[model samples]
Target: MRVDLFDFDLPADRIALRPASPRDSARMLVVRPDGLADRTMLDLADALRPGDCLVFNDTRVIPAQLEGRRGDAKIGATLHKREGPRDWRAFIRNAKRLRDGDSVDFGAGVSAIASDRGEDGSWRLSFDGDEPVELLLERAGRMPLPPYLAGKRPTDARDAEDYQTMFARKAGAVAAPTASLHFTPRLMERLAAAGIGHETLTLHVGAGTFLPVKADDTDDHRMHAEWGRIDAATAERLNAVKARGGRLIAAGTTSLRLLESAARADGTIAPFEGDTAIFITPGYRFRAIDGLVTNFHLPKSTLFMLVSALMGLETMQAVYAHAIAAQYRFYSYGDGSLLLPA
Candidate 1:
């Protein structure tokens, strides 16, 4: 398939610079076999059927964006993964200029020495401090907003809360699991009243999420690894939900990917902890995640391709065009959609 198959034109204004006023007040564009339907984020409870189970990625977004001056060069960096107490894997701007032995001085007096290049293009950084890197992140880091967001920078204040989900408490991810941001406490109450169930899982969003798909054909695209875990109790709950004839609805791509990665062909979910780099594409068999709630993704990106795999490619593009024509918000803090296989 041509990489362009997943591409679509998006207007500049559609990219959301900030989240909706009331987080769950964001719009929702429902794409079904019949056609595209417009709705609001709060309508999700009404849109989904009873006995459907929701699997949410509870991984919290860390304030991972930081500015550092290495030598005379001022560079922006995002912590991708933790390599150790003082060591980390990070993506830096102007990688060509940053060489080995360079040191980064993060604001609030924290500093790190570039140690080595990791598996991909990211670097290993060993910090020079007694304060845990998490503390430094709280003081020096900003939300690791996507590059596409324009107008104002991430420090605009509202992003600090808007970029996170209502259920966000655990701290690790560089970005919020966007879909989960749509559910309000009221929405959760509605789902519960209808007998819908939800379980939480963790998959810390990383720099891998920001990687542009470079493969000429998606089959050749290598997945970026992300650390995630499925606890025994949650696994048992998922199995019980399935046995009770509930449909599995993954709240975001991250959660869906984690579930698929840990699922057995027999539909059993087990306690799992470690790194996962499962890449979903067209023709891939989905062992888990029968339905998905997610936001519109960037054109020509792996996320767009993943949704294309879940729904047909043609339908995915068509739905996107409809969303654009209808003026729906896009990206991190944008509108959401619920999808079932074609």
Candidate 2:
């Protein structure tokens, strides 16, 4: 399909710079086959059946954005994937100034050597210290905010807490699973009280999520891989939910992709651990999830394509048109949508 088919006009003012106070106060646009309705995140539990399970991504966002210098050239790095304990694959901002074996000083005693550039143009950066790389990042790195927000303003101390979800535990992701950002402990308690159970999986969201689709056609676009994990116990529980006629609702595209990747042809989810580069487009069959709760996505983005696949392209196009006209916030720090297909 033509990538241009997914394009839509979004006013710049609609981009949210900060989250709604109390998180759950954010508005949610419910998109069902029948019609669209407006609701707050606090009303999420009421939007779904009691037997449904909301799947969340537990991958914690690391401080992966770094600024450094090699000789006189300024360089910026956003670590996307972990290659080893001390090695990470990062997208560089000043590639032409650096080469294989060139060392970059990220300041605050953190430095790394660049090597083995990938076809995507990202470089492998091996940290110099024997100390854990996490510690190095703590001293030198900033939260990797989505470019849409970061380009408008600067990342600050507030982002250290706002960018992460309450379920964050396993630290690896360069980006937060923003859909879960609307969830608060109060919301969790409310959901449990409503008998809407929840579970967690991990998908270390990379900076690739922010990359634009420059391809003219959907077939020409390539998705960068992100590491994810689903253990046996979680898989078994998820399968049991399906068996009992319960719906599995993914709280984010990260969770949705991992669930679909782990789904067998027969639609049972299996234990999985590794990288998934699943590029969900229109005409793709969804086996694992019944619905999705996700943020408003960029025009012509893979995320938009995934949502279009979930609920036909025409439906989502109308949904976005409604969202835009309604003045709903957009992007990572933006409002959300609850999409339930017929």
Candidate 3:
């Protein structure tokens, strides 16, 4: 399908620079096959049945954004994936200034050597010294905010806490799973009290999520791989939910993609570990998840294409139109939508 088919006009002001004071206070637009309705994140329990399970990504965001210099040239890098104990694949800003085997000093005694530029133009960087790279990042890196928000305002201490979800534990992700940002302790209590079960998996969201689809057609667009994991116990439990006639609700596109990657043609989810570059587009049949709770996405983005595949192209267009006209927020720090196709 033409990528232009997913394009939509969004007013600049609709982008959310900050989250709602109380996380659950953020508005949620419920998109059903028949129509749309306005609601809040707090209403999630009411929107879902008692038997349903909400799947969340437990991957924590790391300080992957780094600024450095090589000689006189300034360089910026966003670490997307872990290649080894000290090696990472990073997308470089001002990449032309550096070359394979060139070392860039990131200040504070931290530096890395760039090597093996990939087909996508990202470079494989091996950090110097024996101290864990995580420690090096702590001293020098900043949270990798989505460009949509970063381009507007600088990342600050507030974003350190706001960009991460309550479920964050296993650290690796360069980007936050935005849909999970709306969750809070109070909301979790309410969900549990309402008998809505919840589970977690890990998908280290990469900076690739922020990349734009420059392709003219969906077929030409390539998705960058991200690491994810699903344990046997979790897979058994998720399968049980389906066996007992319960719906599996993915909390974000990250969770949905990982779940789909682990699911078989027969709809059974298996234990999985490793990278997934699953690119979901229209005409794709979903096997694992019954519904999705996700943030408003960018125009012509792969995320929008995923949602369009989940519901229908026309249905999502209308849903997005309603969201825009209703003044709902957009992007990573934005409002969310509960998409339940009939």
Candidate 4:
């Protein structure tokens, strides 16, 4: 199918510039077979049923944005995928101008020598560091802001909080599992009181989630691989929930993708730890999840396609139109939606 079928228009104003105060106060759009309803994150407890398994991605977003000059090229950098501790695939702002053997100097103690450039203008930039990637990135990197935030740069204030989910523990993602951002500790307690069960897995979301679907034919698009892991204990908990016949609801597309990737043919799950390039588009059969709690995504982006994959193309289009008309915030730090597969 043509990827253009998934495209929609979003006003610049609809892109959320800041997170909702108190986080959980953000608007919620619940989608059922009938239609969509506007609500708030406080309604989550009521929306979820008892024994429903809510899978969460606990991968924390890092301060991956780096500003440095490579020769005369003023390039903005985001460490997208890590090939090794020192080798990274970065998306440079002005990638067309740079070629191999060009040196991109990061701030003090950190400099990247460009080794090669890949298709789609991504560069294989090697860092000049002996320390681990986490340490190097933390020292010189800025918070990797979403593209929607114009003229806004990360500071020490927003740096600590802006791109993080409440339940983050593991670190690797360049993007936050944004749906988790709407949750607060109090809200989680309420969910527990309501008997809505939840579990977490780590899918260090790469920059790939933000990539637009350039493929006219959806099948032609090759997905970027990201690292993920599920331990034995989490697997046991998930299995127990499924054995009780509870509906599996994913917190975001990251958790949903990992769940689908870990699912066995017999409808069972196992401990999974590795990389996955699992790209879910429309018409794909889902094995593990029945519902999704997510945020509105950018038009023509992979996230929109993922949501459309869970629901239907027509349903997502209508739902998104409603969101746009209602002035619901979109993208990271945006309002959320709950969708069940149709």
Return the candidate ranking by lDDT, descending.
Answer: 2, 3, 4, 1
TM-scores of all predicted structures: 0.95, 0.99, 0.99, 0.94
Which candidate, 3 or 4, would have the higher lDDT against the true structure? 3
Q: Native-vs-model 1 lDDT?
A: 0.85
Q: Give per-residue CA lDDT, model 2, range 254-303, as digits (tens).
A: 99999999999999999999999999999999999999999999899999
Highest lDDT: which candidate?
A: 2
lDDT of 2 at 308: 99
Mind giving the per-residue lDDT tens digits that candidate 4 earns over 40-133?
A: 9989989878999889999888888888887777877888888877888888887776778888877767888886678767888788858887
lDDT digits (tens) for residues 1-342 of candidate 1: 778788888888898877777878889887777787799978877877888899998888888888888778887788988767778799887777788898888878888888688667788888887988788888888888877873345466777777788778778898789999888888888889988899999998887887898888877788878899999999998988888888899999999999998999897887889999988888788877779999999999889989998988889988998899888899888889988664
- Pairs that collide, model 4: none
**Candidate no. 1 TM-score:** 0.95
As for TM-score, the candidate ahead, 1 or 3, is 3
Better of 1 and 2 by lDDT: 2
Model 2, poorest ten-residue lDDT window? 43-52
| Tens-place lDDT digits, model 3, residues 159-265 | 99999999999999999999999999999999999989999999999999999999999999999999999999999999999999999999999999999999999
Clashes of each: 0, 0, 0, 0
Over 4 Å off in model 2, which ranges?
none
Measured on C-alpha atoms, candidate 3 has an lDDT of 0.95
**Overall lDDT per candidate, in order of appearance:** 0.85, 0.96, 0.95, 0.85
- Model 4 residue runs over 4 Å out of place are 150-156
lDDT of 4 at 107: 79
